[model samples]
Target chain A: MIEKIDGFAYILGDDINTDDIVPSHTLTMRDVDEMAKCTLEFIDPTFAKNSAQGNIIIAGDNFGTGSSREEAVYVFKVLGIKAIIAKSFARIYFRNLINLGIPGIIVSWNESIFSKGDNLEISLNEGVITNKTKGVKIEFEKLPNFLTKILEEGGILNQLKKTLKG
Target chain B: MGYTIAEKILINHSNLKSISPGQFIDCNIDLIMVHEQLGGRIHKEYEKLEIDYVWDPNKIFFILDHWVPAPTISAAQMHQDCRKFAEKYKFIHNFGYQLDKGICHQVLPEMGFSRPGMLIVGSDSHTTTYGAFNCLATGIGATDVSVVFATGKLWFRVPESFQIIMSGKFNKGVMSKDFILTLIGNISTKGAIYKSLEFHGQGAKNLSIDGRMTISNMVVEAGAKFGIFQPDNKLETWLVNRTKEPYKLVTPDNDANYENTLEYNLSEITPVVAKPSNPGNIAGIEEVEGIEIDQAFLGSCTNGRMEDLRIAAKILKGNNIDPNTRLIIIPASKEIYMEALREGLMEIFLSAGAVVGNCTCGPCIGGHLGVLGSEEVCISSTNRNFKGRMGDPTSEVYLASPAVVAASALKGRIADPREVL
Candidate 1:
């Protein structure tokens, strides 16, 4: 299966910590819509309002560092983030995203080539990323079979659900 | 090729006879620690599983410390949900909504749940703190933990191991916190992402259990998956009375394969602080000295043990906190709180104009207690210094050892601990 994800890029800088993604104070709120409003509120007050559905997050190193608050990733899920491409990611954050069936990609950062609002096309099977706006193609290491299996199955919960049914 | 301690522990817990980094393997979890997230963030995913009965009720623990005393009505409701869940699942180790129990990381070990050669997972990031006992412990998200609750098993992509060999003794006022802060500065926060850090050498072996816990607790700051120590007499002796569970000490083979090795002589390290906005933004005492602070915090899962309290008391006994600065002290667990009270450390703190609060993660996560105001600067002994971690995003935090936090509170600025000690 040639799984592909394409979306407009939303650029972010280095060390976009979990606190910046989903501030601790907002964790008490039960509504996903209310929590999504505060996504990246600390780093950019307009992020939640401006971000469009199906937008991909392109970031610098150490994205989603600090705190194991899955709400940080949950906000992105709620914001309709299609995929996350970064130079690196914190271990727990990356794991959380993958467990939730979100595509978290790590690439060697090229600051000059990718710009905000650039159209991006990611091929999960081919391990290639195409910058549609700039006409540049970059390759990345594909996720391992087990991880892709989890993603294909619509996250660990669904996988577990299937196993339980079996 | 020999396996690292992390590999050995993973292999011990799993059915695999041989394991290496990046290979996904399912391992039986020895312990699962839960906090408020179990009722809140984790509950949503847990319900998806639709499994009413846990795999093993005895294997799980619930400690409500993050929002202890429930500052908000919503938080109080979450506490109610947690109590109902515990009752439904028959979790025997549930600590309930007790105000005295304290942080899960500290309280779990004190209750004899953590042991060497165990695979422990918690919903909180600082769950790595249990690695001080040589356990292959790491943190995971709510969805992952939800699955563990039903199966008593979790998967791991065995992390590549890094060797941190420590030698020599720490200088006065320079403690494990200084060593870890300096190391995090040296190896940027992203340096150890997806890697396991195994502390070794004479200096690591010589550290008290409290000091070792402090080191393991902050490994998450450097993005390390686990910060395990080499088990030795200190841990073995300490565990003698804490647990009756017999366990073998897992150690790396003499020729264990390491992704990288770094050596440090503790004597050469001095008191350091992580400047505002990041735990990796390290600055020595001289570099950040005399920077005025509005508040000083002396507690967290990172440095809230009895040893940390004693270090603060030594400097605060005869001195009053600066009138302009507010000081807050919280012990990590009820055991540590009782110990501090018995040792008269609580008196020194109270007489020094410091507010001694019950054990809660308040203020650390900006949840409650003594939150900071905008533009305020605080010197804290807590682990993280991320923006708005203690309060408003505009407020700044300087991370230091207990000695530095105590001395800074007295001077109303970032002060050198050596001067007071």
Candidate 2:
């Protein structure tokens, strides 16, 4: 698992839902790459391209609050979004991110102290996220060992694969 | 302190004799269902696991809903993939569109596959509907579902229980949908995040099975993990005719600890509606009355049942839908459709100028049957009114009960059901 990491940051509003993550209108799609390009297009238009370099995303409460579409996580992973730090998240969306081995950290941050162009560092070991631009440190509940192990093995599938082999 | 209904159910489902909220535990799933759209994602994840076979295929339900009868070529292919997976695994619980089970939420309970004192999960968000039967059902993501398919187990964080001690009697025209709408409006969509709403008191007992299902199914919209009612005679009768398996009913202890309690009186609630773009954007019927509408939909897992159809039919039997507006009625399942047919509800709808469709979650997800165009507006019985929920982003959807949908259809705009009845 990632003990610490730093990446560029992006910000979003409260109640950002799966529909906003990926609209149901065109969800007949299958390819992750194509779908990744279409994500948040209604809101950020260029989010897909900007996310390619593994940018970090910061958002307000209830992120991924609508729908149980796992594609929400798949698209984020494919687009190279490294991690998400939010106030609170819908349970299914948070689980989807963890199951896919992507980081979804719930933490408290002052949006005024940070901007989209800023940088943030997440330390999974210390259970804290530091806004490198403004040097703001926020504490969070570190994930349990079992969940951390799933992320360490690059998702539950890989872990399951190892279990099967053993 | 004693255990709440959710805690009791979780304890029973888990190997543990007792459990507390906030503890993460691995528990076996009593029923795990996948609609075609979610099944597509689950199948992909299952293949990624490289598992040769499902852990327990019989326990899984391969439901051919969401895009029933294949809306397009690609959708047809998705169903085809699910069918092949079910056949290859010899999973006998598969319910194809042709089987007429309707939506999985409606069919699963009607067929007695969803029993009380069990833990159920599904890839679709509305799977919380099974909580109506006193089962601990919740929506799960593709990853969790894939894990369940591989091991028949998934990890869960036990949720705190929030009590709703409901009382009073509803007005004649008021239904359970009205009560839930009023509650959602008061609590906001995310008010009950990650908590289970355990309903009790006279109001909960007065509701029928259908009413209970409507409330539980929409808990996800309120950001609640579960909306449950203690198993009563209404539920007992519903299960007695359907279930062959012996079952046990669990209820909250008298001194059960709850995170919070909110009391509601049935008489205080009015016919309500969730306006365009958000389920939480709610208002009384009078506030939205006379808003122009192009369509009125009466279906989806939330309200697409025989009782829902009967409610709509009763108001429209001697009336006609507005010529400028279109009305579409869908029974939730094949069995529901048959029951409505036997009851002449279908005749009432057809005679009232509404198009009665088969049992499918078509227009609600913007799948098919009656999708809206730009600038169009609809009053629908289904849950959720997010942007482009039924069609173009420019289109608008107002969520209400089946009675509201029927009343609005007759007036070509949003109308209070009480006025019509």
Report backbone clashes per prediction: 0, 0
In Å, residue B214's CA in model 1 sits off its true spot by: 0.4
Per-residue lDDT of model 1, residues A1-166, tens digit only: 5368978988888998998898889888878799899998888888888778338999999999988889998888878888999999998999899888899999986767788889989999999999999999999999988889888987889999888778
Residue B228 in candidate 1 has what lDDT? 98
Clashing residue pairs in candidate 1 (N, C-alpha, C atoms within 3 angstroms): none
Reported per model, the fraction of native interface contacts reproduced equals: 0.78, 0.56
Query: List-wise, what DockQ does each model earn?
Result: 0.82, 0.68
The digit string of per-residue lDDT tens for model 1 on B172-226 reads: 8888999999999999999999899999999898788999999999999999999
Chain A of model 1 scored by TM-score: 0.95
